[model samples]
Target chain A: MVQINFAKREINCKLVYYGPGLSGKTTNLEVVHKKAPASKKGELTSIATEGDRTLFFDYMPLELGKVGGMNTKFQLYTVPGQVYYNATRKLVLQGADGVVFVADSQPDKMDENLESFQNLEENLREQGLDPKTIPMVLQWNKRDLPNVLTPEELDAKMNKYGAPTFEAVAVTGDGVFPTLKKLAQIVLEKLNREYGLQNDGPGGGSAPAKEPPKEKEPAKAPAAATPPPKKPAAEPPPAKEPVREPAKAKAQDDRAERERAERERERERERAEREREREKDRERDREKEARPKPRDFNVTPPAQEPAKKGGGKGVLLLLLLIAVIGGAVGAGFAGKLGPLQKHYDDHLRQHLGGGTPAGQ
Target chain B: MAMKPSDTDQKLRKQRLIFYEDDIGRINKALENYQNLSKSRCNMLIDVEGHPVTQVGSTEGINLETIAALVAASFAATKEVAKILGETEFSSLTHQGKNESIQLSIVGDRTILTTIFDSQDTTVGMVMFYTKELVEKLNAIFNEIKSRKDSGKPIFNDDFKDMSGVLDDMFGDV
Candidate 1:
């Protein structure tokens, strides 16, 4: 989850490092903490056992000085990669906006890498996110070790999502910053798309100018409508010799015209009222759909929420049925409606039951 | 490349705490009042994920960012311990030291309140009482923030090309 604090003009994003035991997940963070400028980094906090293995997690926060007028900060965390600490791993992965999977490249650690990858996918699914769609990067750490798996082999075996991959020796800071920078770029891109943020050029601090004009356009429409009648009334009177009958006729014409304009305005007001009611109904529906569902927190594992998919298929099927009906009527096949209706019903049932529909 | 609308919509549904100017003002005011009444050394607010929200008091020697992270993790670990003991949770945790002590209490569903005070300056009873009262006030403020309709707008533009340069400047020297 991204925290945008308008009060302080700050934006915070969480990024997590995940991998198997002894995979240098912590080493990557340690290297970055050491190399990053003192002004831009915080103290590295680690909760480790007596043997120096991480017991809980290691965290370091980095400050990326003002980006587009907001103080952007990234909180980097490394989950304990030991197998039994999966509960802690799930906790750390809770609100992660992006993930960096640091895979140990040694050939002997292949099984561990695969297991950890599966675990990552399972945890992400439990959080109601698609593993394939989330912003992610892969780092093949321990590249300096002899007899390590080649990048080609690792990509073929463990790069299931085709995420950007880096070869790094985290102990020496090789390829570490590049991996982090790539992850940040993709994460920012995702944020920009989600929030509909426009690029106002480099270092520009101007507020979004698109939304205000859209709102003003609707308000101006009514104001513009009221002024047209006033303009006609303000025009100069005809400069000619006055005849009583012609002047009386002109007065009657003006009265009838005024009544017609008044009736038009009344109809427009009714239409506007109806539009507002429809908008309110739509808003209510949206709120109901968006309301979060309550969950029992005591359960050892996080509750799984069903993935939302197949929404567009229903609308597509409805359109296809309408098109088929129109074509049938054009061919003068109205008498054959019974068979067509039966076929459509069968197709709909098959599609809903997870079977391929006949036509498609 | 363009993203799918459904994907963007799913991303938008994630739980996020957006603090507007008014929301931060109220939170800071509440924290200040708690400090005055409790007479503690200092206090801080952090989310369940260990991100610092705000802090108030004499935080001269303390590393607040580090403390916030540790406190959040400890609170979570304690929650697990509570489950093992057949309880819903232990809402408040206290660590008593020889000269200084700390108190952590869950303010609302999403945030925790932590206060550090010298053992000699205040008793556990006083700190606990003040903590309870402060938690109630903080909870109301959080509820109001959550119900606000116009939280705020995104501050960043789409161009992220400059980020690589910024990272280089910070890390390249080292």
Candidate 2:
């Protein structure tokens, strides 16, 4: 489905590249990503495995500045080509506005191409899309290789609805852009026919009517567009007004219905954005709560070592040890001095005469 | 000759979505509620075809474009798993991780809601609960969009004068 952003004056559409394994679906995207101007292309992202096989898909958003009157952007995607990846392929096919089926051109690969085409049809059916109606382009890739089925042969087998087909050597960038241009043209035409929309620009309502066959020749472009312009002057009203009048009324009704629905969605987006802002504020508050605080010192003492500083208790212990040793040495020296011994004996006899007589 | 059921149904089906100014607000509200409730790192509203419609939240380091594509692929694969197991389909799928996880569920039939969250900050239970509620809200909105009647007039009956120029500029002489 195409999304129109009136606020940005932009239109976004999805286009997928699908094929059997190694059929150059990814190569087509690689060429476009390589050749598209830097300004016109977004980053090319590939979600592949170690062997470089696309596991999920490849994505690139190309900006076509402005078409009709709005900024038109095309998102290109490629599904994994393996048959076992059918689930993934169906997923990528969902809501696709357009598709490009890149077929392997080798003669032996014909069966694979047919199988892939059937797969595409079945997948489109599951998504409620008709392969007959969806704007799809066929690319006969690896055209530069040998023993490949010719474009006509491949088209007969795979393009049952006669979608625009292209012959390409995707690795060399040949036919890639032409195929894309054709697809975009058809997609836009489909949008215009179904939704009353043309890319936003000059000749907005006047251009598509002049080239009706262009839609059929989506496979051959740059050349397909060479047809002479039709009654450009008389065609404006009959071409634009009559079609637009009934469409405008219906468009307005559609717009009303769409508006009602989009309004609710818009409100949800705003509410979510506001909630995100508030959540960020709450996260900041939590961080503040977890921060260190000076008040914590009141609960537990500050971490400084008093023992390592060697203060009052250490000095008192050293002084006590020195006094005990000095007393013991002095007693031994007094015993060895005779004069000092006689004085000591006189004092002993006076104080303890009864104890001395018992000793004698 | 009898036409197939799809051929007849195609005439009445609308293939595109049209938005007015007010619709943006409602979409935001639903997405905002989900992000808040889940505390997700990011949220993306994508069509089943892997196109991103709108996104919100902390999308840093996330390549939303790639995420949108892969989410659809993985979800589709999971649906196949359910079919193989004899079930109709899985309602939702969550890919858990040590630090981050992603939850994917359909909003209506055409859209998918993808949410990426951090397990360290929020629980999977919170993400699943809010995601389910958000899907219901979004489903209501998408149903309306899907039901819109389209005007059958050709949008650009005008010649594709600009298309050639675009192609030329994008792929010069290719």
Candidate 3:
């Protein structure tokens, strides 16, 4: 979870990249690590086994300095790029303030990408995060491959959520930082709105950028909103115009006559406001009362099924077993076919298989 | 080491006349062995077409036609159980109650035996044990028949001559 200080007016947030194995998730992070402003990012730490690769990195914007007023920091993480280690992937994704899905652009890997996305949703559901409301960005990676699907095709396949999608060449740092910046901006906005919640004290609850202190000072001044016109036949707009001033002297006169007329006008207005507010409050209360009593009504959302929860670990375990078993089965097949001396022949075949001869 | 009888091994020669009758002796022996576990007269006669193989326990109070029907029903129930267990090797099925009843089994092909028990005495341990031994004996009988067929001989090779007496003794009360 990211914490923000209203006193310092700053916000912090985390963005994680989630995707399938070999879908260039780690590559996207590598590209960002190489290209981010050197002053602001930390070192990349990788924990890899013979079977999997993990990505861990951070991005701090010195230029954008403080959000509100605290140092704006964006910590980026890439989930492991292997099917088997989904337990670790889910752990990395806990408290994910935001997500960027680095989707592989290969046509054959399309289904794999989609399945991984579904796994992400399932994991998030297990974690109690609604994927739709979570700020998400999609980076369609590996644009350099010739056989890769076109941008339109990939978008049609993966960008159904209307998440900001980017065409990325991670090897050369093409769309890396741009994607990061866009997602970072979104994360920042989400953080502000969330932290800006605390700033919702008395009075209107407009946001920081929308209503600065100087703008609302007059509304807060409480200098008895001036006396009404003695000629009570006057129109409402011009009649209340004196109270709208910020002038110092008028501020004083407005205070005196304002105190007397203000009480009367305040009574009438408060009574009117009270009537309207009370009516609204009762309507709101009645609506609330009616709403909760007939909660079985389809219009009222039913109690959510307490999450049928499990980590990606089961599917991950199955996939891992399948991978090892498949590999063993393949090796057994090859050994049975060619005996112990087959590696030399296989290497030769690999070398001779894809010789570059130009043709259409 | 042990010789066991299997009725399904081969058909017995039809006895035109009986030199002697052991029907009472066999019925007495059956009742002595299984007085506690047996079905009601109504449930035992579950099938109309099946022959009244036997009514094993002391069902003396029930009339002859009812006994015949109950015996046939017992066979049909055993056969149905055989069908359910899939291999036709179904040894036995028994329903149990506490107070009093009758249970029976029909041996088939001598390779498989179908046993059915419907009774208030729900204790089925003895029924299952006896049924398994019976099926094993039946298997040996079928195995002998198979080997005999392999050796290419007529089935009435004198080894099965005594079956007529056994069969007579098994159902002669009718």
Candidate 4:
């Protein structure tokens, strides 16, 4: 999921494009990269195998500019779409914020499409994400293909989950931006629902009135958003004459500048302190590097010389003491910890980390 | 009154992971070389198979059996509070003894901030308060490490394995 930082006014999220091999998953990403301005897209990484188009995965970080005054970014990724790459695909799906399933719409790729959907379900299950609940949209790609399955048939099969579906010819960028925009908007809506980010949308949408948090206000107030039922405007206190603050506003501006300068000074002070700390850290590290080294720590040098001399008389007694006393101490500590341990075991038995009653 | 944790907090309980065993060790080593901790011991960062991911500390050769139990308890108690208040992660867990104590704080979903203390030297409350701040710093370190790992940027060696879920349904309901 995405999190919006209100104070910094930025939204961070991860969006992954998933599908089977040769489905234009990478093609979709490449199209976005080529179209987006250089400043908006990060360098793309593609790992292609000798025989396959995509070997591992491709990752591109795209800055989706700012939405509602918060900087928006989407890190788009494509899993290597081979049957054998399920392990890597599962890893990449570990923390998906939003998913775009780019299915090849060509008639011959129908079986591949179905298999990929199953794989997606299995991966989502492994990651504990309910496919029904994860923010997702489906994109049927290669729509321009004459032999491609009709949208109705494809939706009936693949988009049966009722996720928002889009048709795209990713090669020529048809329906690409619209798909991205829709998914991005869905991602933002989910973020809003999750984090209460009630900011207006990108097109200057009016802010929705916030529902007051259910706190300790009593029954005297009606629950509706209506104004107070009665107004107590009977007070007759005369209004004070309008105060002219133009002269004072100048002083206020000066104070504001002073505050800004003070903040800058404080920042500089902090930087200097950090530099000093770094220097000291370096000096201390150098000293540690140059310091005299201690002799053997864990090694006992095969217990030679003086140890053998003492072994004749005292060694037997020492060994006996160690064995008997050590055993008793260990047992006592174990017993003391047993009650708490049992309580934990009971809980573990109930939870059954190894999964039972249907978990695989 | 306690602050209400959001549902987003619950995600941290389930899906959050903060891993930095190597970075933590390097930090602890610098502290040890500087004699910051009197015991020259590092508390458990990740309670792995037999030993804690530790570099310095008096908990040398501590049995993993107890720590594993403790980690489970810590998560259970936190989960209870989290589920009740809609929070996902916990601030910290502290246990006091006659002359020692151990504090566990959530640094990241994956990583924990642990502090071992002596009653003769430090108060439990003091350790709790300070460890909270320390865990905040560790949280940043965890985030940095995670982002670096995610971006395919190479850093210090990272050893993350596909471990099973930390808790399960068979575990008693909190």
Candidate 5:
């Protein structure tokens, strides 16, 4: 999960290291924790047995500095990789934004690797996450060990979704940071796409789009002719904008005022959202009341209220049909109405003639 | 409207864990109180996922990291045992040793409160009694932090750079 707290200006993301038992999932986290500076990393917590098999999981929170104007923190968790601990594994997989599957490279551990991969897929499916779409990286650990499968072989078996893969020893820290770095970049890119932010690649590529890159591109022209042309193409608009630099400052001030207004609107929206949620709870209650048809049909009055409201249009249509049928039947009796009118006229004439002698 | 599957997933992923200086101050205060009342030598507030959220008391020469991890694992294993026995969960676990004893209790939904004391100095009953109050106080602090809706802007702005520099320093010359 990538949590963005606008109020706090913080972005928190969870990355889980998953693999079979004894596959160095814990070791991967330990290496990163040991290597990460104190300022950048928090205390590494591991819940394992005396035998050092992780019982629950190992957690390390790393601050990867600011990106996209938010301080990004990655909470790294490694699930208990043993097969018997599948329940715990499922619990930890609940809200993962990205995953690093650490596959054991030893030949004997192939079955475990396959089984864990299957478990990961099943768990992700159960969580309603598409295994293919979630950002993932594969690390084939214990690469330094003899009689290990090649990276190609490991990928052939386990990397079904073709996530970028890395070869790692994990214990002596071989390929540890790169695995983390690549995963971080992929996850960040995933978020950038999700939130509609431009991909500011690991290097702050967009910020220096105008000046420094142009000078550097010319310097690298002898080595590669391809680099210089792209920046030169995008530079013209920015190059012409220096005359508007004074206005840019004013625009920045306006942006600040707009941001304050946005914050106020955000708070208002949040209050309205809470009200909506409360209303939804009432709706859910009514739905429950309407669910038991036979028993609650008479007992609950509101249950019938929805049916009436929903059927109101149908009821109106039925009444219109009846009215049209009645009109058609009256039209069929129009000839009968003419004869009755003649009989009434003859009766009226007889009464008036009696008063004035019949012949006259 | 029913949420789309991806939207629901995004909602699940969106958990903001912000610990500002105020939160740190409250946590340290509670730990101090817990230590004084329980006569515990050292105490730690650890997340259930096996990470230390904060710690207080004398942790000199103690590998608190390893202890926290093992304690969480042991507590989880015990909870599983309780489930097998048809118990919902045991609120607290106390281990008695010749010289030292450790008490572990659940704090909120995702954290563990651990207190270590010498058996001669403090009894389990005393520790448990004080820990109950500590949990309540800590829970309030956490809830307040979670519900905080401050409108002020964050200090870091365009002046911030070198996120990768932090990582570089972390892995430098290793």
Candidate 6:
């Protein structure tokens, strides 16, 4: 999810790097963290095992200081890629604005790469996210490996959506920024398409409508391959000059003036409504404070009380019991209940205990 | 199970959070008051999905962004744990440390209020007392913000081509 805060003048987006184990998912983050300017990058935090494999996730916050007058921050995360950590991966994938799939280029890792990609799709579906619609890029990592598969073979097997793919050696930082840049670009473009000034409607409700057209004009230049200089000088002044006849130009100007005045009136009305709402809120707060109410430190909020009041607990207990019995029966049928169940229980306990407290 | 179209749309809408200047001002004011009353070192309001909304107090040595992500993940994992334990969910969680402790409480349906305070300065009881009151106020504010039909105009222009330059500036020669 993208968060836009007008008061703070900040925009925050979450981008997740996902792939199979040992595929350089964390390496990409490490390279970005090491190479990114000190002022722009936060400390990279990783929850890993003694073997240095990710156990939960790796997180790093990148601040793009200010872009187009808004403080843009990207929180980069990499999920534990081993198959047993599916739960952790799903948790990390929740509310991701974009994703970067880092696939290993080794021929032997192809099966693992394909399996991880499928797992990513399944998780996206579970979260009600369309894998096709979400902004994503594929990075074929470890290109420097001696027996690496070619990019075309990797793409044929994995790029089902045909997303923008990059070839990279993440350990040495070959194409990390390009991959990240492409993903960020598409993500920002998606955000702009969804919430840009064009959605403000035909009334020209705000001043932003007038500026986007001018900024968009240079995007249509013939030399699109060349980077468009962001200077007012680049915009042709004569094109905007009044070329219409005096009568028509004057009439259009008059209509524009009326629209401007109408917008101002609308703004004033909104301001007045906001003032009323603020006052109402203040009054409610005062009333709440004045009223005598008993507080229970252990009790949940009123909104959550109904769930507890209902027979939800009983049903959940029944379900848990059934699950335990079913697990025991199945394990007995397999004739390896003891060792497998013990390993499963130990793994569950370790993840549950160590994964939650991400504080120092 | 596959989600219905309407359900998916509603879920997506819930995922996005846009804060106008007015909402930000009110939320910040409330957070500042909570921080003062609770005597906490820092207070952060983060969405259930882990995006940091706002914060107050001194966060000089902390990696708040990391904390926000981890806290949300922890809360989510705990929700799953509660389900396994025959409970609906845990509304609040506290982690006690030798010197510094943290409290995380759910606010409204979509956000969490995380307070990191000195264990010696204030007791958990005091923090929980103030949190109960602040949560109600925040819920009301969030409901009002949600009910708003017109939340001003969009500030971002349609031109995203300049993002390349922005990226280059941030990650030079990397």
Best by DockQ: 2
Deviating ranges (above 4 Å) for candidate 5 = A1-16, A21-82, A87-98, A104-112, A124-135, A141-157, A160-162, A169-174, A185-360, B1-9, B149-161, B171-174
| Model 6 clashing residue pairs (backbone) | none
After superposition, candidate 6 runs with Cα above 4 Å error: A197-360, B1-14, B150-152, B158-161, B172-174
Q: Tell me the DockQ of each model, to 2 decimals.
A: 0.11, 0.20, 0.00, 0.03, 0.04, 0.16
Q: Which stretches of candidate 3 lie over 4 Å from their true place?
A: A5-10, A50-52, A55-64, A197-360, B1-174
lDDT of each: 0.69, 0.68, 0.46, 0.53, 0.65, 0.72
TM-score for all predictions? 0.66, 0.65, 0.36, 0.43, 0.54, 0.68
Interface RMSD for model 3 amounts to 52.6
Decide which is better by TM-score, 1 or 4: 1
Residue-level lDDT of model 3, residues A1-360, one tens digit each, is 343322122233557888888777777777766655666565554555545455322222222343322345555667775677676566566556678898888899999899888888888767666676566777788888989997778777776666666777877867666566555555554433332332333433332221111111111122122111111111121222222233653665466455546544644564475457545655654554454332233223323222213466455445544654575566555534332135334434655886431110
Count residue pairs with overlapping backbones in model 4.
23
What tens digits encode model 6's per-residue C-alpha lDDT throughout A299-353? 4245545555567676644554465457545644444233334544554665686
Instruction: Choose the strongest candidate by lDDT.
Output: 6
Worst 10 residues of 3 chain A by lDDT: A226-235
Candidate 5: give the TM-score of chain A: 0.56
What value of lDDT does candidate 3 attain over all alpha carbons? 0.46
lDDT of 1 by residue, A277-311 (tens): 55665665566446442222122122211211335
lDDT of 4 by residue, B1-174 (tens): 112224443452234332333454444543343222222123556421111333334444554323533453355446556667987656677777776676766656655556666554435654554454456555676566656632211111111010001101111111
lDDT of 5 by residue, A1-360 (tens): 554543334566778999999999999999999888788887788768999998878887888876645667788889999999898887677668789999999999999999999999999989777787677778888877899997767878887776767778788988787677656755665554333312223332332111111111111122222112111111112222112243664685487458546644654575476457556655655664455444333334553445545556666445544654465456445433433344345535766656431222
DockQ of 1: 0.11
Better of 1 and 4 by lDDT: 1
Q: Per-residue CA lDDT of candidate 2, range B66-151, in tens?
A: 67767776777787889999987787888999988988888776668888887754677768856776787788887776676543
